[model samples]
Target: MTRYWVRAFLSGLALSAATAMLTVTASADKLFGAMEKAYVTNPTLNAARAGQRATDELVPQALSGWRPTISVFGEVSRTRSSKEGVPIITPDGPDVDSVAINNATSGNVSIQLSQPLFRGFGTVNQTKSAEARVDAGKQNLLATEQQVLFDVVQAYMDVYAGRQYVVLRRQDVSALEAQVKAARDRFAVGEITRTDVAQAQARLAESQSFLVNAQTDLARAVASYVQMVGQEPGKLSYPKVVSIPNSLKMALDVAGEINPQLLAQAFVEVARNSDISVAFSNLLPSADLVASAAGSDPDFAQSKDRSSAVQVGAQLTIPLYEAGAVYSQVRQAKQLASQSRIQVIEVARAVRQAVASSWNAYVGLAQIIKNTRTQVSAAQLALNGVQQEYQAGTRTTLDVLDAQRDLVQAQVLQVTAERNRVVSGYQLLAAIGHLTAVEVGLKVPIYDPDANYKRVRNKWIGTDVKTVE
Candidate 1:
């Protein structure tokens, strides 16, 4: 007997394992690859990345003005001046051919160099402005990433919801099919009327319509996910999840301080304020080393010692006056600075409002979840009692069916409540500016925006780093 029992147990285990393996295989081709698609082919997010890289060039461009510039210039030419010159003639030796056309093609080449000796503060201000813009670009990249994360989360949840609804509707259809069978069997025994079976058929048809709607929703959600992530959403098994916030005020506070969009706006204000300094710098003198070398043939027809001239010195430019264009620029810079400040204030206010709203939603949805749980429990108990009464012949068919429908609807509401609660949690975290790819368990190559800044801010000199100064 022990040997027989051992063999039966082994057989049962093998059968169970096979069934599980089949189920796993059947469900394999879906959501397991969503993150891969997101990291690889998300166009909107990639475009933002490219923008960030482009903005990083400003740092190098600003640093170039601080470095030396050198040029090796030469020219070959033949020219005749209309001005009166020494009397000349062809062979007659009079002044008839007065126009002098000296073959002035002389090799005059000198490598001249100009370096900025000093600027009031223009270089400093411009560098600061560029740095600020780089900071802003980093923030913009962060904001773009956050937006993409939200889109992925929202799309993922939508797909999960559609799938769940499909299952729920399928269950309802199955239950209706069972009811139709029971009704038909009862009618053959004369215990039920033809109307009852017809009613059951109609209910099945209604459930079929619901199935169609659920499938339609699933298709749309899948399309959106595929567009965002660059892969198709197949079958997925999403865990029943909860989003719980530890503290609303804490979340709100964190988001207001770190939110990328808010930071980006603040950086813009800083950049524009730096522009004010740049404008002020224009009012100060600019000192630059100026050098020029030229060898001119006064009379190439005669000798080379008469006309070659070379000059090398520093040029200092002092801003004296400009029909008010410089002053107008100063005013404009100040106005822009003021506008930027106002924008920061406005964006801060808007951030706070968003925080408050998300906080409220999180709290409200938590309450709804609690209430829905109670409703689901009560509905389930009521459904059990109605089924018991129906089997005992104390409840009418209509009464039993009504209870079942109510229970199903209650369960559906419970699903929606859970979904909303978790989504609200995501929204709360997102509002506080703490939404990261890691927080959502996404595996992506982390983007390092500061790396670019560090690389160019210190090393960029002149227009080209390798150019001879």
Candidate 2:
């Protein structure tokens, strides 16, 4: 009967294991699916894209310098004299005490257009500077996307790792409960002391406590996953490690070429160089073609006495001096350009260091994962031997318990190493500037910054209206 019962117990355990594996397989959600959702729905990423669109307007604002500015004016006024009536001269004669000349109502309408002929090449450089800034904004948007995606990857790993920990903890609790029951049965049958049963009970209690702590950690991980990916985590599919750069040197090279932050700073340096050109241009002369037409009525209610005039001329402005502010600005711009150049170098070095560190971490985690898996396997074998020895009365119950504890620890370490491996790969990808939706091959619409820029850059009308949302 005992042999049959033992066979039934082993069969039940095997069935439970099979069921758990099937459940995990059936309920799995791919990591890329979560990443795609985050890329599309993360508010931070969307806001960064919107901010880049806003920065796109700078190009059009600078382009406005090449376009003519038109303005219209109309005014009505009552003119009155406080002094006594004085003599006023008409076209034909002079009149004394002329109240008509002292008081009158007048109105005028005028339209003027001014086109910038030249601004010492300042307009050209300003537009170029704006273009550089727009490029920088694009890089910044890319950096934000990388950052959000990295966060999503981290959260996903956290939830998965936490779930694994919970599973191990539950296994520990179940194993200890069985041990406690076995110890109790042995003591009642005069096979073991009450002290053995007490030890088993103590271990079971500790395992239960650990299980509760693991549950708490899993809850926190779920919350973080929801916050990052915009939804609750389901059963996670097997993690996929991203392909890495061939070598550390290649990784550093890639980062220098495409790391979004470094690229953004590079564009910033370019814009600052253009700024210096704009500042120097301020010292040179500017020319504008100005034209105006006006109509005036002396008395709207009286005679048809109206006059019209038209004027067209070119105006040149020479900046002789302005309290040394222009020269000061030029000097400041040069200093700023120098600073930006220094920052570019600094950022490059920083990128290299980040890539190196991330590469080392990824390599270390890979090794740790391999070692931890081996450790789990060895520990499981040892625990099985210890259990067999305890059944044969050749090993103490405490020895079996210690072996079980070691196995649990090894399993936890294996899970943690696996989590770290995936997360480190993501870190490496981000350090090399490939952690973007497009780079990751996510099936989502890419936001184009130039679309809004093109929509508003050549917009000549609606000066007071906004054309892009």
* TM-scores of all candidate predictions against the true structure: 0.76, 0.84
TM-score of 1: 0.76
Instruction: Name every residue pair that clashes in candidate 1.
Output: 255-432
Q: Write the per-residue lDDT of candidate 1 for residues 1-469, one digit (tens) a residue.
A: 9999999987975675456445544454433256446654678877877778668888877888789888987655665446456577667667853765534444455667889988888888888899899899988887777677667667777888888888888988898788788778878998878987887788889888989998999889877876677555556655334343567677667777788778988899999988988888878899998776666554446674545557789889998887788788989999998998898888888888877887787688778878888987998899889878766768766665677677678777777876766566666666667666655555666667676556666664445421111
Best-matching candidate per lDDT: 2
Off-target runs (Cα >4 Å) in candidate 1 are: 1-41, 78-111, 177-203, 239-245, 296-308, 384-401, 438-444, 458-469
Off by over 4 Å in 2: 1-27, 78-104, 183-202, 463-469
- Summing lDDT over every window of 10 consecutive residues in candidate 1, give the lowest-scoring window: 460-469
True-vs-predicted CA distance for residue 464, candidate 2, Å: 11
Q: lDDT scores for all predictions?
A: 0.74, 0.88
Provide the clashing-pair count of each candidate structure.
1, 0
